[model samples]
Target: MTNVKLLLSAHRRFNDLLSALALSADIQPFLAKVIAAVEEFLPDSKVTILILNQETNTLHSGAKNNLPDFYNEAIEGVEIGASIGSCGAAAYLNKTVIVENINSHPNWHSLLPLTQKANLHSCWAVPICNSSNDVIGTFAIYHHQPKTPTAVEHEIVNVAALITSVAIEKRELEEKLRFNASHDELTGLFNRAYLNNVGDSFISLCIRNNLNCSILFLDLNKFKRVNDVFGHKRGDKLLCQIANIIQQQTRSSDIAVRFGGDEFIIIMENSNDLDGEKVARRIHQLILESVSNEILALDFGVSIGVAMLNNKPQSLSQLISRADQAMYIAKRSNLGIYCKP
Candidate 1:
């Protein structure tokens, strides 16, 4: 196909992808679409999108097909550097990288065997950057023959990278907004909003599956004094520490929430009343120890209440009400942990 015609065709596909992005809830489908578009425009080529993981400083395969499984697995978590193959080098330099002959390119020296096994001979890649100019991923094309990218191929790569960047930024922004809506900004724990949304449905699932569950309602004993003595900043720090402890103690199936100021709730799945009390005591003791060790001048304690799901079907609100009552009783009676009858 002529370069002008190919460019026009790719532009139309790019526009279609942008429109689809408006309806895309996740970034994966959009990324797949971008890859498909590139493969469609450039026949006998395989494309892969590698997303950068900021925390790990590594590149992960976000979308790819038609590549050999062994080749994909071999480079699954490849690190980005100046000479780590076409995709890695493109991501590291934040620029376009083209290797006309993979067998002779220094960047592909280490991966040459794998590429040969996969019948890949040439590669070209461009970094996909967000609006802030931060490199988020790379758009790469591989060929079975040792061939350089033509003008048309360059246009296709540019269009695909631009479309992918927009899709990723949109998906990430949506995820952040959704998280803020359901999470406590101060503690980064699930908030009352999330609990209100999922509580009844979760309880119903527990009942239908015949799984035991319990609620642990916790209230800080002297949180007000801490805020009055030390500042709100210190109080926030303490709260974060407590939230971390709660998250660490609970299983992945458990739901831990910062219900409100100085109050927290933990929904334990597959746990009975006795196990609930045990977990409550453990958390209480850990918080006590944390405060005593971290801040020697201040005295802090936590009162926890445990409520178990009985044979009678009940809503999450009912379980929480029972646990709240038990917590107040514990606070009033100076009992560190209490279970509602």
Candidate 2:
């Protein structure tokens, strides 16, 4: 009866700890709590939490208990692999993997340097998966003395994985939603709405730093003819193709936008070697390339007008209006050229 009573008390404490970790707003405190709970309820062990960096496809240490800062530093760039240590292996395999004696385990062989630095022996790792079953991180427990995990220990790790998974997924979804809101539906570029809201701050920073930037006002030549000759569906296809071309030509830091209808905007940032005319000419060349000489014989191409920022804007409305005027000038001059305003 006493043994059963003790077990019940432990279960309640475990639930409380999980709840506290989940509810805490402060990241460091929450991580500390998770480590403490794992140490008290699961085993006397070193606990490390790793979070995945999606861009790099690598794992980085997020938090730890009973481990040196060097352990955190050493584990910063663990890659996913079959022969990687328990945590990295779990991340690669998308499941729980245990190295009972890390010193002798084939998987942990290359990671011996990290173990030597951190004084590791037994290691168990489980992949933390989201509600969608995507692995977001790995939760690892290390024992100073070599030991095989019991079923209870495995269960505890699984629970920890579940918590980590939820946290990551929540963050990912929020970011995705924010991105969607800021971007255009058709071209996956920043919308006019996004620009209207955030343009001032970005442009202001460029001006303050004495940075030279260019804005291109692009319009598809005789797009009305395109709609009249081909169906609206074909026109949409052409627009998507144009968007792809714009994305290909511009740097990742540059902002592309489907300004509306057949019009597009490109924000050329930090242009040292990047002349607006060169970018415009390159885009014009590509558009011509995408079609053919036969299409050129038909006199079809894109007209682009560019404006550069040498000084801070008096008003964005006036600045954009001048660029728009330049675009009309390009249109009037005929296809296959860009005008600088």
Candidate 3:
């Protein structure tokens, strides 16, 4: 293709990718579309995108259109580091890596046998970066014969990397927004709003399935003293610690919420009154154990009330009300935990 024609083609692909971004709700399929665009530019080469998992500091295949399954599997979960491979090095260095001869390049020496088996002789990779300039992934092209990237190929690599970065950033932003909407800012637990939204649905599902749903209401004792004695910042730290303890006691199926200041609620699925009480006591003990020595010195503790769904079905609000009443009784009597009658 002529240089002018290549430039025009890149422009069209860029527009198409933007349109896809607007319509695409998922990352994988959109990445596939990106690979397709790159394939159009170099039909004989195989294209792959490897995404970095921040927690593991490893690269996983995000999309690969023309690569063999075994080849893809071999590179799965490749750690990002210097001289690792084309994609790994590109991601680690936050720059492009071009290995014109896979067999002879030091980076490719260890994987030479695998590359030969896969019929991949050359690789050129560009790091995909987010708005903050953090490298999030690598966009790479592989050829069957050793060949250096031409000027036009370089342009194609740059465009593909830019497009992929935009897509990744967009997806991450959507996820963060969704998380913030449902979670409490202070404790990172579900907020009362999220419980309100999903509560009725959960109750209905339990009723339909003949499952017992339980609610545990927890109120912190002497929390205000902590805020007054230390500061609001100290109080927030204590609350976060308490929240983490509660999360540890509950299973993934349970919905734990920060109902408001110093008050938490847990909705337990398939739990009876006995089971709810057990979890509440466990949480109370753990919270006491996990609190800082300074916070414990202030007599900070938790009072819990356990309520279970009976034969007469009740809404989530009613269940929580019963648990709340029980919690007050526990607080008044120094019981630490009380089950609703």
- Backbone collisions counted per model: 0, 0, 0
Clash pairs, candidate 3, are none
Kindly list the per-residue Cα lDDT of model 3 for residues 1-341, writing each as its tens digit: 78779878887978887897888888888888888878888868899988899999899887756898999999999999989989999999999999999989999999988999999999999999999999899999999999898888898889888988899899999998999999998888999999999988988888889998889999999999999999999889889988998888888889999998999999997644478888888898888878888877888778999988888879999999999999999999999999997
Candidate 3 — worst ten consecutive residues by lDDT sum? 269-278
By how many angstroms RMSD does model 1 differ from the true structure? Answer: 2.8
lDDT of each: 0.89, 0.76, 0.89
| Selected candidate, larger TM-score, 1 vs 3 | 3
Candidate 2 Cα outliers beyond 4 Å, as residue runs: 1-29, 53-57, 113-117, 185-188, 201-214, 222-255, 267-275, 290-300, 307-314, 338-341
Model 2, 1-341: lDDT tens digits are 35455446556755775577566544566667667777876556888888877677799877655788777777788788767888788888888898899889999887788887778899999988778777778888998889887766676667766766665665667678888888887778888988787666667777778787777888887777666776788777778888888999998878788888988887777556357778888988888788645434545668888777766454455556666777888888875555554
Candidates sorted by lDDT, best first: 3, 1, 2
Task: Rate residue 257 of model 1 by lDDT.
Answer: 97
Candidate 1, which segments miss by more than 4 Å at Cα? 26-29, 150-152, 202-212, 269-272, 292-296, 310-314
C-alpha RMSD for every candidate: 2.8, 4.6, 1.7
Error of 1 at 260 (Å): 0.5
Worst 10 residues of 1 by lDDT: 292-301
Q: Which has the greatest lDDT?
A: 3
Please report the TM-score between candidate 3 and the true structure. 0.94
Regions of model 3 farther than 4 Å from truth? 270-272
Over 1-341, each residue of candidate 1 has an lDDT whose tens digit, in order, gives 77898899899989988998898787777787788888989999999888999888689988756688898899899999999999899999999999999999999998877988899999999998999999999989999999988787888898888888888888889988999999999888899999999988888998999988889999998788888888899999999999999999998778899998999999988645488888898899888888854353554678898898888999899999999999999999989899997
Candidate number with greatest TM-score: 3
